[model samples]
Target: MQNFLKKLRFDDVPILDKASLYELLNQRFADEEKKLSQIPNPSLLHDAPKAAKKIADAIREGKKITLVGDYDVDGISSTAIMIDFFRQIPYPLEAIIPNRFSDGYGVSPNLLKRVNADLIITVDNGITAIEAAQVCKERGIELIITDHHTPLDTLPEAYAIVNPKLSTCSYPFQEICGAQVAWLLLGLLKKELNLNIDMREFLDILCIAIIADIMPLVDINRTLVKEGLKVLMSSQRPSSLIIKDFLNKSSITSEDIAFQIAPRINSAGRLEDASISLEFLTAASTNQAYKQFEKLNSLNERRREWEAETTNEAIKLVNSDDTIIVVAKEDWHEGVVGIVAARLVEHFSKPAIVLSINNGIAKGSARSIGNVNIYELIKQNGHLLTKFGGHKMAAGLGLDEQDIDAFRIAINESASKLNSDDFKSLDEVIGILPSSEIDIELLNLLESFEPYGEANSRPLFLIKDAQILETKTFGKESSHSKVTLRQFAHEKKSIELIQFKRVLDIPSEKKLTCSYRVVKNEFNSRVSAQLIINKTYNY
Candidate 1:
């Protein structure tokens, strides 16, 4: 492990030695520091300031405000953030999240009709909700959209639009997700009102959303997480106590948020009720928050079971003929299908569509690999879909059962029209390594690449031929295997590298090449390093 990473570093790969690199990272971090100063953030377009003024006026006048949030964690967190911020002002506000089972995604026309509010703010979603916005317009309810999805050719006719992707908009970073948009709005509000509130308080919540939403952790996002983690570690955030008690970690990292907290936040919507997560995030007392946190933990465990089983079943249905992977199961829960689709795309190195069939209408989530654009692919075959919306890499759609075959052919056909080789050619498989390289210092450098998700992926290193020295299996059912490898490739240096979850499939006496990440493990009051295997091949 020690010699492996150094051997893997390439000339073209970015080095920290350059002044520009440090300058850029510093500037980006500074920009994040001063984010709150830019109230009525200049990045947003089309009456964002006007909408902020309206919201501020509503607060002063004590008018009722209803928040319409989407179904995902980003939406829920955005909802919770709004609720938390407003409650600080102690403003009169009510939050309404659309149900995935009942109201479906986006701001539902029915949901809007039922709510009585002078001002309605939509988070994580609403830019594409043309008809629903019209309903709000007709009912004399002012609508403000603070979404971060790709805009349509024609935007919704609403009171204000605040998406970064709009061509007319001047937002510097267009790639931010919806939760970030909500954070930006909050930043603007804090600045305009001359509020003395700590900016880092909101950033702690934002760190979770940033990681949970799988947005790129580059530029502004990198800074948000960098400073957000500071606030979290300092335990200064007033709103993160629920999350604090839930994990019970002495120190919080972005990885903790992504793997531990975000999933729990998301589990509510996936397994049962989204409101459980909202309640947990906004819980006032430690006891109340702990209860909700425990519930979310239970829901997350169940969600994992469902995801693992559903993905295994879906993989069996994938045919070798299709350029893309399309699999559906009627029994699959609609909420977790997106996650399953993402897993399939990652495992198979192909675009994947996981669908949940209900009432002859197949609701599906699509995830892509590399440069493949699932949204554009769906758009090209627009006639086959009842409705679809998303960015290039991900999308959601509804299709009729009768059109399944044609839909498959059309998507595959569209994929075939492009360079199929382009998708797989980028995939590189590397060798096994000596374990000594996985030291605390390198781990620190790798750890610096925090808040990893989506575009900013975790560092993956490759190692060449190492011989397996020992093998063992763990877990109640022996479901996981761990292997130790030995290598003395670099002269008088021999090291041990552990390959986890590979003992069952791998033979003990064999030479293998592997790719992995270095993770530090503390046991028996001692610290050592381990290699988390990514891909391996036996020789």
Candidate 2:
């Protein structure tokens, strides 16, 4: 655990003099507030108004409408938002989420064949559904696509398409997630149809999608999450309330969604059909929501089991000399490969792809580190792949079983050409703090930067030369450590520090330098400042 200190990079946040702390705080808050105030209008999104008008026309004409969504948290949340909005307008609508195994991803021809509707709207997917869009066109089904994925050179021929990343799109913020795009569409529809629906009702779930999809929490995203957290804690939504109860959490935070709620929602899609998650989010009553929550919770547990098994097997296949880790096995669960790939990336600090071999085809998930664009790398070897799509950090692909070795060799060669700095581990430190400065007042000031995620990460500070007063190990496996420390100038003031999944061997007589983040630990209705240790240097 202590070895992590050697990889630390304290360059991101310069150490500021104590006298300038207040000025720095004020400047950051002012900058964030200014960015929030300049959020762009949804009207700026290309084809948004056109899509809204088409949707309104279908509802007015009583044309049968079906929503086609992906099998992920973002897609499920997008489907729920649209379903809730349609219910308010008293419009009968049908929703369908693709099954990861049968339906593959996005709007497939098989999925489209199963649906019979005059108008088909796709959320969170359809940006790359060229053939599926052709099928819809031939079948005379009107298609309106609302997605946020990176677009290819030629877009599908749909009735209307709304995506911020479109080459023609002038929307100022292109990094918004799928659910936010759905929310924006609903905002326009509410106005075009003169509906009196409160858009804020959807933020609680929208916030989850934004964070779960790893969208940057800045500008409009920051506002959505900040406001969404308030709505989530109010417990007005049955789904949110049930999730909170299941997790035994008194209040919801960005961390809660990232680690707890999102995984449960995603588990359904990963293990079976994602429609279970959609049902959970859109359940009409508390009892129904609870039932769905229980089902999702069970699925999540199974997912964890499969993920652990696959991760161990994949790790065994990693070669130390390889620039990229590519592992494949027969009978491995396809649903858990993505999680396994991510774990490999974390453990090996390199790009990794885990494939599940079934019959003669290999379906895999790839995860990247630092500057490596996994999507671009996979696309570069497109000749060997049957299907591939995703962003820079992560991607999914399929290929012939025979090509696995060649594909692995190709990606590793590409990865080897990159600089070593791209694969180095660097811990971003905010600033240095003395024990005297560790108090509730400083923690409260840090709270101003709420809803931390991708871009706006939680602040981390380095505390130098702190003497350990006490130490203890806990948890089922005794893998967690709790310690009390004090600085030289403030020997009387001791602070509690916690390190999860790591058991530290520190002597009370020695002083250590620690990098940590300030967090508020709540217990029995009381909250206090606590330090979450990320790395410790024995000096």
Top-TM-score candidate index: 2
What do the candidate models score in CA lDDT, each in turn? 0.73, 0.84
Tell me the lDDT of candidate 1: 0.73
Clashes of 1: 12
The window of 10 residues in a row where model 2 has the poorest summed lDDT is 28-37
- The estimated TM-scores of all candidates read 0.88, 0.90
lDDT per residue as tens, model 1, 247-327: 565556676788778888898887777998888777777777778888988998899888888988998998867878888
lDDT of 2: 0.84
RMSD of each: 4.7, 3.2
Candidate 2 ranges beyond 4 A from true positions: 1-38, 244-251, 417-427, 463-470, 485-494, 505-514, 535-539
Q: Give the alpha carbon lDDT tens digit for every residue of 303-407 in model 2.
A: 998998888888998877788888999979988999899889878788899999999899989988877778888888888899887887778889999999999
How many Å off is the CA of 449 in candidate 2? Answer: 0.8
Best by lDDT: 2
